[model samples]
Target: MYSLNKIIESTGELVSAKVFGKEQNRIFQDNFNSIWEKQRDSKLNIAVIGEFSSGKSTLINTLIHRNLLKTGFMVTTAAPAYLFNGREDYLYICAALADRKGYFIKIWEDGGKTVVEAYKETGPGLYKTLSKDGRSWIEYNEHLQFPEKLEDILAYMTTVEDAVKKMEKIEIFLPRNSLPEKMVIIDTPGVNPGKKDSSEHEMRTRKILEDIADTVLILFPADSVYTQTFEDFLNKNAARFMKHAVLMITMMDRVQEGEREEITEFAREKIKNKFHLKDPFLLSCSAGRAGKDEYWRSKFQKAEEQLMDNLRKKRERILAERTAGLLDNLLQEMNKTVDLKMEEITQKESRLREASVPNLRRTLDESYKEREWKIRAVKKQFKKSLSDDKEAMKVQAVAKVREELAKRKKRLDITKYVQNEKGLNAAVTESSQGMIGRAEYYCDLAGKKTLELKKELDEILIKYYGTIGAEAENEVQGRHAGSDVSVINSLIGNAITDVQKQENKNANSRDKWAAGIGIGVGLIVGGPLLAVGGLFLGIVGGDSLFVESSRTKVLNSFSAALPEIADKIEALLIENVNSAVTEQSNRLAAYKDQLEKRYQSVYDQIVGNIESQKAAVMKEKSEKEEIKEEIRRLKMNLEQWKRSR
Candidate 1:
């Protein structure tokens, strides 16, 4: 470790050290926790959704027992909701994050500000504050006036940009269930006049709901059955939501014996097959009061959970496999240029020895300025997409009044009703006014945003081309002292110099060979004559001395050393490869690291958000039991009231 690192570690309690330690702890946790959650978050896009009053809330209630959905309580239940466990899996409230095939669903308006408003409204963070007096007021107040309060909320519902912010600021409504399980539950406006009265919020809700709902659980009251409106909604928006729809037949308890099975079969034959769907599940349920006949409810709940779990796993595996493939392909490219790579690194190192390239550094610094700004801007947009969209605003305004009206036998609450009616009309009229104009506006904005991005892209193209051209110029004019051929030729020149050494060695060996042969010839030819002469003169000859000296010497003594001469060219070729390899390796690594780091944040953010969502869903799961308990209490209270009556 560096001295700084060691110091940080040794005295982590020191003020600066503590600060850095805390910061590093966060960084490391953020990085590792993000990656660790990736595989977990890669699960399927499980969207648990339904039309108003269909057991969407119940299913959520059953699956994850958090009673986040307000029924006969909250200002709305038609607002889409989501839940999931934090370990893995994710849900994007339609109004917020509508990402299709890894592409952002861009706003066709003023920076999607309004749409972003809808997103934030849908899933307003975990209701976490405490002791809010506003909480009781938001739900109801028998002491004051119920209809008036309804009217007040309804008037503001259509154009409330800061509803969520206002709701958060209030000190009264602490979340009923703070730790919710993480499965995205999208409760939407039921089909018909219930929503049409105040449909702008509904439409905005729908636009978002349609975009995010991969799987829609279309609910039908078993007693009433599927109406024309229901079928029309499904058929018209088949493109919007079909692959992930489960037709739920609710209120099995309301029907007689065998009706559940019969209705399910009828739906399969009439609806499922008509849509060409295979084994699309049709669940029979009651929100909280499906008594005695618990079998169907249990099965329904199980199927939803299984489907969600399975999808989550599937999505994760797919992304991982695909990302891995991408990495593999990139790694393969790095393996190329094995020889030339080393030379580049060597040159950079040589340059480092002399000085830092301030001009090159400054140019990169300037180039990144725009990129940094763009990165921040894109991140802000992304954050907006991830935030909440007050779901209740969409269908709540309509559903509340409709339900309240259904229970009433008398005339309307005229004073408040008239105000609500005006608000509803104003909402519809405002939206309708933009019908032609908004269509045109969307088209124009799409084109304008496209062009603006295209211009940026064009700049990128220019930069890319300019970079390529500059690199090409550098390559064309580039020089390498090592590759100068003169340097290498000099080394090769020594090979010729070594030739003299070999030649001298060869000459000595040749002379010895020649002398040996001559002596052998003389000895053989004059053997008889020499024997007679030697006896007479005692062998006192100078020729004998020369022969004796030559006999001791050997030819071909340099043969072993000559073997090394053949390997010189091969060694030089290897050295050339080594010289190029380092630079090329460094370049490849730098590019890879840059790309990985560039994408790392996005990946980490995605994973963190996804895992967080999963935890929320799991919380929902656990809370389902709690909801059941509450229902049990409610049911008991109902029975006791009946007994009293």
Candidate 2:
């Protein structure tokens, strides 16, 4: 009866206590975030992806029956563009300005038929201008006179050399007649080597395919054979892709009239053999040719219908899979924690038997002496472990920061950010600020770990105290056990409250922890594709544009500055963590004294306490089994639904 969001939140809290491997943790966060976003935004995203010269833009243009997207025989779209409809036609742009300064410009049609009649408005300053250099973001927009202007702006925005600086993605809002209310059609940059060669572009394209694409149309020019890039893309993502994929054999008009049918069959059969798609959509277009629109629509009608049907089913399947994946992760962590506790309990029991009382009367006083050396050793080890953890965390923070900067170097046009004197300072300052932010995130994570360590130490003390009480129970029970029971009961109650408080603290801080985890995560499907950091956009002006040669110099400067930035961040994190660690250590040290005082009163009741603890653990384990059974039922139901569909 639990809601998915409630379960997700609980799972994040439960599993986040332990550090999974870096890669596993990143995957979990990305998947978790993806599912979270999916539940929040239930839009069907159909991504059009392919090599350059594959007629992807033409397909979109034909679908909408508007030449809104610029197309040609070469690479036309420079960046990924999104097309969807809004209540009114509007343009929202994040413009890249000098020194990474950008503007969020909005141009809207105010009850006008033409683009020229649309008015531009900054309106109540819904956006901010970045000038301080640290983490600069830009946005810009302006009205257009005609629909044709959309093509012009899109062309300019997508070109690599002339592309707007830090213009990450473009969103076009049109009338309901032009777009489906629940659908978003994405036009991605070509991934072919001879076309868009940038690794960043390739990464972005792959990321869309892997993470966002509800349905993918892999386009190919009809006259040419499939390129290696397309082939490799299929090879890598065949399992998931085959479910919602349709190979589009485009530009069929180029095929000789007598050979068109043969070519279509050949392409279809080739796709079947290599990629497993049996019926490739055969499409050809002559933009200005008479009745071409009719021909294009007629050719695509069946395929379009099938794609829509497949997309709906696929979305449902994805939701189920994502939810199950999260549960699987949570279950793993729970099992690990339980197994560890059980092992510790067994060890304590064994130690108690080995050191059993020779004489019951004398053993009561000596029980406290038995655990003092063990407790002291544990306290010492805990301090050393904290120090080592601090060092490891510092190293991880620095390395993560460096990796992100390196990724940015590949994703962002660094030269553009440093083209002018102001820009150079701004880029450097932003880079430095980014480094500092990364350091702070890890330092906070270490502080949380310190809190967890304190909780753990408390548990160890309680367990060890229970062992001492078990040994002395026979000797002290008649006189001491019944009267002083409240003392040990109070300590145990406090320990449980501390654990509950820690869990609440972790849940409250989940957002920050999630953001920190995102710092180390990159898009999983592709290499550095999307520039997630500090996006800038706007009309290119004020000396922000750069030549190709300047990129090397700007990147070199960033590379040189990175280590220095990382060093400062590392030192800062270490200082912050050390301070937190010192405070936690003092608190834990005081706990030792509290434990000794409380235990002296309950010397005879330790055996009963141990029995109670074991009973509670068994109850918890049984509840976990029920939860596991419920999850199994959910999975079976999901699978049944998928099969029935």
Candidate 3:
């Protein structure tokens, strides 16, 4: 199961659902479920696709001799078939992904029972290319060749040539068995054969081949120079499976020595000079019954052995790449989270230092200074006005006394005159006394106001500069606190934990991820349903181009697999993101509340101080007015004596 080359396919398939939104995921899942209908032994899935006489089944029979499929030099098995697998008294069923036409084998033991199973054929009821042969059933791609058994191959080919075809394909259904199956070899219809059925079968084969065949086993019959079919197939689509393809030249024994040597040399030259291939063996062998001339068996075994070893290397390489990618993504995400936290803290600290507590207090203090300056200026102006008014009143008092004296002098005979003058003077004197008193009161009020202003200003300065909230805030320079500092802080702590936590998470968005899984009815069952999706899977069986090289195969597998890993990873990330946001928003709200309280407290203090200063100035002015009234009477009496003179 683990050696599944399809693991590459499966991984790609599983993760793709997470990639193209839920829509793509549904499509992929739908396809997989629709197709992956069979169970098989834990056998290697060998998809044999080629021309009608490309010896695809012959190769399979060669591999599984004990269960050799009857081959008689023409097309024999018409439907896709499986190679039975057994190990340790356990039988593994070889089948296709319940969805697609390609064959694979897997093994399973349920309660110590071993059996192989394909979709139970309910009837001979046919749907387009689909057919049922006894208990196991599947649609047959006609291009898939059974031509190694000559008579059957000719019968089928003749039907294909005749064009009036009834059977979509001649299908052979193997009996059902429990999977954990061994290699299920898929034989595909030959492409571009002269017969009409050949075209029909070829098209179906091409669809599957282009779409889902993970690895292509291209068989080139030995002793024959590369044909246009081979050239065209290799040249046109070599890139698709450039990472993992197997090129096999069968029937090497047929070639004479000189021809054999030339062919061998031709193969080597074709690999290096034309195809520019390396490392991958260009094998020559025969897929016919293992007899005196069965050279291909040895080559097949060698190829199988090499492939098995290469499979491990490939798996390890894939694991390494994926693991590295996972680690890299984790590192990136961790760095981003940490950077965000630090940035938040830095901005807050900048605001705290450059725009918060200190600036707020500075603004308040500057306002206070301006207010104090304005008050002092106003008070000085008032003081000068009071002083000037006092002097004017004194001058008026002297002038009135002189005017009264002149009146008394002009009316000599003193007693009546002086008494009259005194009466007049007394009346004038009463009016003058009120004005003088007002001036003196204004002077005293201004002086007392000045004193209170100085005192209150001192108190306000002290208060603004004081207070624990302000002090506590000023101390936090965005650095860790010393002594009783919170040695373990949440934000910083989370970063450390994230760094230490190396987890391979599947998806963060549980809901969305789950949605992805349930999106398509096809993938819900998990198999290849590429037929429904119109995938060109049969291209591997295109009549002439059956032997694509190895490098192409590996690349094709990689291309199919990697994106799935990324998708699943991203899904998990998005899920986590939602949770993080929810949690962080709650905590942030609490902090905001605290900030609001601090702002309000400071705001109230500034407003209250301004109001208090204004009230004090008004009250001081009122009290000073009272002192001026008493001073007025003394000035009025002096003025009266001058007037009597």
For 1-645, candidate 1 gives per-residue lDDT tens digits of: 122222222222222221223554454344333334443443233444334455555555555544434444223443333343433131112222232121111111133222111212223342222213322443332122112232233223212333422221111111233223233444454434364434543464465444444345567777766676657656765433454455667666678877778877887677765677766656566656532347765755665555555444343333333333322322232233222344444554454334322343344445444433432243233223222211222233344334433443322231133224343333222322222232233323333332343234334323322221111111211112234333333433343335435544543554555555555555666885654554333223323333333222111211222223223322443333333333332332343334334334443554465557556545544544443343344334434433443
Query: Candidate 2 at 276: error in angstroms?
Result: 6.4
Off by over 4 Å in 1: 1-48, 72-78, 86-182, 193-198, 238-240, 290-645
Could you arrange the candidates by TM-score from highest to lowest? 2, 3, 1
Write candidate 2's Cα lDDT for 46-92 as tens digits: 78887777778877876676776777776556578788766654533
lDDT of 3 by residue, 148-255 (tens): 232233244334333113233332233334222333445665554446455466655666565534456777766454677656655664444434566677776677
Q: Indicate the worst ten consecutive residues by lDDT in candidate 2.
A: 534-543
Model 2, which residues run further than 4 Å from truth? 1-30, 89-102, 107-150, 193-196, 237-239, 256-297, 309-314, 324-628, 643-645
User: What lDDT score is found at residue 382 in candidate 2?
Assistant: 39
Q: Which model scores highest in TM-score?
A: 2
Worst 10 residues of 1 by lDDT: 100-109
Best by lDDT: 2
lDDT of each: 0.38, 0.52, 0.41
Query: In candidate 1, residue 472 scores what lDDT?
Result: 14
Q: By TM-score, how accurate is candidate 1?
A: 0.30
